[model samples]
Target: MNKKILIVEDNKTLAKLIAKKLQSALGLTVDVAYSMAEAKLFIARYTYFIALLDINLPDAPNGEIVDFVTEKNIRTIILSGNIDKEFRKKILKKNIIDYVNKSGVDDINYIIHAIQRLQNNAKHKVLVVDDSRVFRKQMQTMLENLFFQVISVAHGEEAIGMLKSQPDISLVLTDYNMPVMDGLELVIEIRKTYTKNELCILVLSSNEDEEITALFLKHGANDYVKKPFSKEEFSCRINNSIEALENIQMITNYANRDYLTGLYNRRYFFDTINEYIDEVKNSGEKFAIAMIDIDHFKNINDTYGHDTGDKIIIALADILRSSTNPHDIVARFGGEEFCVVLKNINQYSAEEIFNRLREEVEKFSYHLKDDKYINFTVSIGATLFNEEESLEENINAADMLLYNAKKNGRNQVVFQA
Candidate 1:
């Protein structure tokens, strides 16, 4: 998507103010055109991510610029001062994103938020389930217009299967009545596995029965949209649902992550690893659990102060996060101590992995004031998984080896399988 915007407003002062805001706030390229003629030239020269068009312009007075811009396949939003009910209604019918009254700075802020919303919409996928092929296509069109990745199915059963295969799908829009599996049944089936926080479900039906609406909401449907809805209402509901889901996920991530390093916290690691362990435990595969600690960390902190010491810890965490495979787990247990799990590894490979990690930390340089630098080293201890032992035992075994490594010398890896 182009990081550029075209604003066609006749008022020079208002146009420049909005342009400044778009450029400064969004870091986007802004092109302002005072009339339809200039807009045509700009549209011909550059492909814009979105266009803000004025209904009344010097060259085109009767909202002719809107049709011209829309014909160029540019996504448009009207920044018009015209508040006539008939004119607003007619202009909105064009495939434009929105109509914002150019009343004050408040409207400019809304435009900024709307652009941010559109950019985020691309991250979500919406599943549309309707028995009528026509309705399915209509919903698909509207969703795509709002920049959402859309998947359409003819019935509710296919919707379930799609969710299973594509669990990352963020929202489901289903018609209440369908063959094989009705929308209500689909909602119940979906709630069996996914929570409202995990997935959003909205029912779309022509039926206005209040009892039916209550039943759908009672059975895990986030919302119900009646058929023949306006584009503004539909857009608002979908955006709000996605934004809510994003907020919930942000909070969940904050809870499970370390504050400074942004790695998985100790609690999250232990809490989530059991299911993975169960899956691979009986596969006759060997795994390595290791304890890593910054050697003489207290001395460094004492000499450099706690702030620099925190910097070193953060640097080491970055190394661990990047050096390991994506499937491998790395966590900060607290202070200068860290833990790593090398999945599906052999005895020799595990030792080599830990040794490489030790070398990486030893060579890293943490710079201080002037040209001075602090070189740090780490101690590592690793143990292979034992079929008969609990996870705690394996961790204890590794911790003991870490102790031995520090005892023998401060910068070494002690491996015991």
Candidate 2:
């Protein structure tokens, strides 16, 4: 489908010219609006992929149109003739995707480039935490306009719940002044739970004092946007922050995930288990550890090539990942073996889970190079942690039970007493 672009220029001649040029040059359907009212009407009627906005429209001066465009979140380029540093700074301060000084020649190319970049870039998800319905809705509209998936919560507590539930959230935009836990308090709480590498947070405040901004940044805020910001400026800042987060996440994934099976690597698994152990020690919550091995895996690898063995491992990883909860830690434990750690699970529930997983593996099938397919089962040993016992003792008990399960039968679940 052809992408849509909205041109919000008050000059009838300029609007028509830009609209025609964009339509002819890029094959975009360009909607021309001469006033903010007309622009709002257009926006209400049709969703544009990108919007070219003039900040100084007759109806709303001081770039009110920028706010409206941002609230709508369509990728925006500000075409402003006002070159004053303060005015430019203010206009660029909100979530406008780009700013083009209209005074220059052939700067229309900048809008084209900005639109192209926005289209090619990945759509990011932002969680907006604010108690104000008006602000939440406003931010939601703006983010959606830019093709971002937005999850909005009315309060900081709700935001925490959202973050815990959705680990794939790309960024968080939180209002600093809110009821039911203020922004700074929320940031500290979230930081305690999720490391800086796991999540990125940005604080929004009406108070723009340098000292206050510094404080917010110190308390794990990736960035801060003062209230009454420009749409173009806000977009630039948001993009910058998201880019930084993407780089960090890429590095983190490389360091923490296993390459072949796409499961948590040994180091990450140990780090996570240690954290769980600490929590269990403090809170007396139950936890369970399981050791799993594909039955006759070595024979299969010897019969078929190692490539086929690798495929089987990858398939098993997929099955395990699908069977467990996101909070459960699953890891490739070298060779053809895997491990699962379920936090807050009692002995009975842990045995049941191990049995289910074992049954699933027995029923799972895989295909090889010549359309040759094979089915296999897994043997599992599980042990629940008793607060009286040490972490290593629990793991060792599980491992011993696993060996017994393999000895008794190739595909079964064994639980230690």
Candidate 3:
């Protein structure tokens, strides 16, 4: 339950400093081991999110510690005094997250940054497309070391199929030459469905042709790497691309989400619902739209205060989020009013889902000062959409039903029946 980091360095002073910084800056539990034997003991006792290891330990001077820790499946970033080209390449081939030279303060800073980056990497998924089974497996292992969920395919066509199946995939690493579809064609096709900000593409090639690299970049690739790249260079490029995409996504998300509860804003909800309708029009799939409002929300505001009311609204938002499918859209229409769009469902199923949510809200008791407590309820109105109907008509019908639910009773779901 506790997030911890292990530091394995013979230099006591340096080890203490690193542990201090990790504890103070990141609030992680830090354990320091001065030798390979000690490090193994720590590894056996506690699970670590990551480990920082000095290559030349007293007990294991030939970088045996790297193999020992990595074999345990703990993510590692190696610290080394030697930066020889061959030595670095050999270290990288071992599938460590990264290897940093122990030079100065900048190196320590890089370690800190790498730790943060790996933490963020847990939320991302990367797709690796290579024709060679050996190359694909190698890449998957490297990516897994960096704490990313990897989906690998043999060729570009399978890569596209994977992308369609997993829309949340954040990065694509593709080989230039393949059987079914080549990398260049794959990048061009991917760009058609996903924009530059939504997905990042990295091309790997043995081709020395300058024009090929330029062409891939011109088309849609975010970065290009030569086949024989050092582990440092490969990890750095991948991290840079993913970081840039995440920054852009953060800004775009803020624009689309409500400022209060972090749910989709009203405008985004409308736009997405229209897109959803367009998507299902030819398939003859049914969907439902629901409008939900907190019952007597103003009374809660008057009794407890606006702060408590906001908490209640946020609580209800959490309920809606947990109750619906990921494909279903839940948004804050405004104030105490919320909206949800249920996909691939009829009026009956939608009613069942919303009624369950209503029961959850009723069961939750909000605590106040001096052991005081209060309960809240929500009224929901929903309607199934017909292919002949428009978005506005469905919303209006749902809204009218919601109004009727509030009028008839405080806590209930009102639909066709």
Best by TM-score: 1
Model 2: per-residue lDDT, tens digit, 1-417?
A: 239989998889878877777777787899998899999899999988778889888898778888888787566778888878887777656766666888543787666655654653345668999888999998887776566789999888998898889877878899888888889889999889776677789888898679888888898888888888877667778767776776888898988999998899888998989887877687778778898889899888998879888989998999999988899999987888888988777888888888888888888878766877788888888877766777678777888888998999779998874
Compose the digit string of candidate 1's lDDT tens values, residues 210-246. 9999999999999989988988898899999999999
Query: After superposition, which runs of candidate 3 have C-alpha atoms over 4 Å from their true positions?
Result: 1-3, 56-64, 71-73, 81-95, 103-106, 165-167, 386-389
- Local accuracy of candidate 3 as per-residue lDDT tens digits, 368-417: 88998989999999888856767887788889999999999779988863
What's each prediction's TM-score?
A: 0.92, 0.64, 0.88
Top of the candidates by lDDT: 1
Model 1: worst 10 consecutive residues (lDDT sum): 272-281
Q: How much is 179 displaced in model 2, in angstroms?
A: 8.9
User: Whose TM-score is higher: candidate 1's or candidate 3's?
Assistant: 1
Clashing pairs in 3: none
lDDT measured at residue 89 in model 1 versus the true structure, 0 to 100: 84
**C-alpha positional error of residue 110 in candidate 1 after TM-score superposition, expressed in Å:** 1.3
Candidate 1 at 297: error in angstroms?
Answer: 3.1
Displacement of the residue 345 alpha carbon in candidate 2, Å: 3.7
Supply the global lDDT for candidate 1: 0.91
